[model samples]
Target: MKPAPFLLTALFSAAVSAAPATHMDTKAATEAVSVYYRNPNPDRALKIMQTIIADPLWKKDSARHNLSVWAAQILRQHPQATDKWCRAMKQYPAVTQDETAYFFFLANTSESRKCLRNLNISNHSKTYIAQNTPPDISSLSNISPADLDALWTTFYATGNPKAVEKVLDRVLDYAKAQKAQEKSNHKNIDMTGVAAAWSARSNIMQNQDIRKIFDTYLNRLNATDKALLQKILVQE
Candidate 1:
């Protein structure tokens, strides 16, 4: 007869645990977490996550980097996990400095900043966070070149495509505004080509959906902007 469901789960866990930390596949672990970490209670999910992270395998740089990136993604999804996540991240301060720095740069709210501040990160990360938290994009209508520039900085720092999307939205809006006015002038932002140019710099644009966002708005830009974008894309 087949073993019970609990017995199967125990056996699987044991199989994974029996592998040496260095031999464990980081991608496999991350994929498993994404698939199975769906507990409704954030605390319970955090507990399960903590169990995995506690493995000696995470002492390696590659594993720790994956863990930190996963931590940032989870925090973005579930801000309620803040206190627990910070406490957990504390256990690997030496390796988390870059992760925490990127997290602080992308943090958009006071509460998010506070949670990042609570982490026991290194002085280098602390200084970078204090100097580089992005300004709030409170009003897209009044968005400035500085705002788009900051988002690009975050994109390069974290390789998150959503940042490029934000720039694309702003450029599209500005293009539409100019088309309505029959004039291509704006606040000297030169943003018409930014989304296409910067997005091309990263391999992440391989996502057809992201590339589609640029194409969807291409017809909306004025002739001048279109020519500039085409030139930039070719040059980039």
Candidate 2:
């Protein structure tokens, strides 16, 4: 078909624009990754980091803070992405140290702590690590469902549904055990927390075997609660 000159120019311009972006090479990718890293979307951050990290010829140290943060986010909804995130971190020295304390506490594995040991840590960060312990999750009170999403972020990073379910069991068991306490802290049962927590994992769980585990939690609610939760899950 005969094409308009503008259309041909547009396509050529598109190719040129893409050339710098794709055939663009490592130097440019590294710069782009560093600048917009502060942008909020972790998934995009991870992809950009991958682009920069993919270039073995590139030299400067990649920023640890953004890599850790975005890696954690990508692993949340996309549980299978653990290897990509983990491998990316492994390439950058002490980027592991850049991971937030919340993730350290959330996963609290020997491996997570091992990252701190290799790093030249500050006295303050050292003290924080030495004193670190699993959060007193059972005692959480006046905690809204939205707040619970923070906890979910930690578990999601693990990319293990069993881990998520275990946390649920602990919280539910404690809630069931402390009938008096539950009543006293009505705010603690904030259904919104469950919704928020689900929101993090919702995308990954959809149409997967692991999704059933998430659904099990949802099933605990009444029809109205379930409907409300579904809406929240699908919302932008």
Candidate 3:
């Protein structure tokens, strides 16, 4: 006997709902998991993720992808949970390229880097690393202004200085272009953001002398701006 049209529609909806909710791609899932990490209810998010990982009917590839990404994020927030998820990913070879890269970033182990370097990443995954990894400013040149803004917001929220510095340099370059385009007085330009960015940069710099870099940038501003920076530096 044929199924009713309404029953078929309901079945399709159920199937889609039961499927894992990932972003556009595996990399997008990485980003989403990062956002979830910063949320106040991280424990709740963890429980939900654990349920997803344990779902027997879930595709092995999708589970591996989700668990690997979630594992790296969990390591950053809760280090103890790392081993179980990492082991699961290793046991299941279906983990995606982005997940492997994330593992390297979180694991910070030689073995993890070796694994990342050997993974067969697609051009898209390479682009993701170029865009997201810290200490790489060149990638910012290829991104759009809106995306750069979003990147700035995320970096600021995460307080991940390495990632912040990469985008901060790009923001400075973008600010320069904005200045030229608007023909605004240098003093009139909103250097509040500039100060915040520089302060964040200073906080992240491990080298004591690198504070000079922020100082040099601060010197270009007016006395009030200099004072504001001084306040930030003092607080730090």
* Candidate 1 C-alpha lDDT tens digits along 1-236: 00111111222244466676674553345335433323334565456455555565444444443334344444555676676656665676555434544443454445567766666666776676667644443333454444444444333234455665666665545544544555545444445334434544332243444466466555777787775554444344
- Which ten contiguous residues of candidate 3 have the minimum total lDDT? 1-10
Better of 1 and 3 by TM-score: 1
The list of candidate 2 runs beyond 4 A from truth reads 1-107, 110-115, 131-149, 158-220, 227-236
**Backbone clash total, candidate 3:** 0
Cα-based TM-score, every candidate: 0.43, 0.36, 0.33
Candidate 1 vs candidate 3, lDDT winner: 1
Residues 1-236, candidate 2, lDDT per residue (tens digit)?
A: 00111111122233335444445754454344323323435455556656644543222222332233324444444444444444545565543334333233333445544544554445666666567554433355544442244334333333445445544543444334344454575545545444434443443353253466658876887775555544544443
TM-score of model number 3: 0.33
Q: What root-mean-square deviation over C-alphas does model 2 reach?
A: 14.7
Give the alpha-carbon lDDT of every model.
Answer: 0.48, 0.42, 0.43
Against the true structure, whose lDDT is highest?
Answer: 1
Q: Give the TM-score of candidate 1.
A: 0.43
Error of 2 at 225 (Å): 3.2
Clashes found in each candidate (C-alpha, N, C closer than 3 A): 0, 2, 0
